[model samples]
Target chain A: EAGVVQSPRYKIIEKKQPVAFWCNPISGHNTLYWYLQNLGQGPELLIRYENEEAVDDSQLPKDRFSAERLKGVDSTLKIQPAELGDSAVYLCASSLQGQETQYFGPGTRLLVL
Target chain B: GIQVEQSPPDLILQEGANSTLRCNFSDSVNNLQWFHQNPWGQLINLFYIPSGTKQNGRLSATTVATERYSLLYISSSQTTDSGVYFCAVDEYGNKLVFGAGTILRVKS
Candidate 1:
């Protein structure tokens, strides 16, 4: 089976511009997560979705970051007025449930200047 | 939030050598997983071992939940193993916290 898929493997934008990343989890997976990974660091959870419901998103920057999972399937993460500090790898992962092993995508590498 | 720490931060090994990576968590966790992030930036799930031990090919992992730590062992290491290894834990089974990762370089 194909693994989780993410769009625009790389993205480059100027500071103050808007950027968006998309993710499609593995088939039959019910849980999806969005994580931000900085250079020399591991991924940090930004938002988690159980089907179409966002169960945990406290780590997400509400002012500039927003995410949505449509119809319990594909998801999109957006950063409005992107800042240089927002430059990082945005990874998407999926699991059968909360406790299952998560499979990750190739990730979208964002470079904000 | 639980804090995960991985050590020794960086390692360099010769091909066919053996090495062990350690991960420590600050609190109790219901799930723990080891992932290998390749040079191209793909995160590959290595093991979903929350406790006990498991082996696959030339790799193995042991997690002692009571001790709040896990160990990943790679034997007969190949150059393909070069990359960053990360350990992630979920205390409530809903959110995952990841360690900074151990950067490994295998020389042929």
Candidate 2:
């Protein structure tokens, strides 16, 4: 099966501008996830979806960051009025089940100037 | 929220050498996994071992769930092994908390 797919492998924007990232999970995978990884840091969970239902998003900065999985097969993560601190790599992953091994995609690297 | 810690934040080794990376969790978790992040930022799952030991080729991993720690062993390392190794865990749902990772550099 193909691995998770993400769009616009790299993005650059100015502060206060909005940026969006897209993700397409592997075929047959029921779980999707979005994570943010700052320079020199590991990926931190931003949101998790189980077939179109976002089950975990406590860590997400709701005021500026929002995510949606409309059809359960694809997802979109957006950052409004992006800040310098929001410059990071956004990663997407998928799994066959809730507790199964997760497969990740080549992250979308964002740079906010 | 859970806390995950990885050891030896940075490591350097010569080709044909061996190394071990570790991960420790602050609380009990039913799920644990190891992954390798390449320079391009793709995470490849290494192992999904909540307990016991598993060996694949020259790579091996052991997890002691009761103690909430895991070890990843690489034998006769190669330049291809140079990258960041990360450990992730989750309690109830599939949401995972990842460790900072162990950056390994294997020189030939």
Best by the DockQ measure: 1
Global CA lDDT computed for model 1 = 0.94
Show pairs that collide, candidate 1.
none
lDDT of 1 by residue, B1-108 (tens): 689999999999999999999999999888899999999999999999889999999999999999999999999999999999999998885677899999999999
DockQ of each: 0.90, 0.86
lDDT of model 2 at residue A65? 95
TM-scores of the models, in the order given: 0.98, 0.97
Measured by TM-score, the strongest candidate is 1
Per-residue lDDT for A1-113 in model 2, tens only? 67899998999999999999999999989899999999888898889898999988998999999999988899999999899999899999998874569989999999999
TM-score of chain A of each: 0.98, 0.97
Cα lDDT computed for each candidate against the true fold:
0.94, 0.92
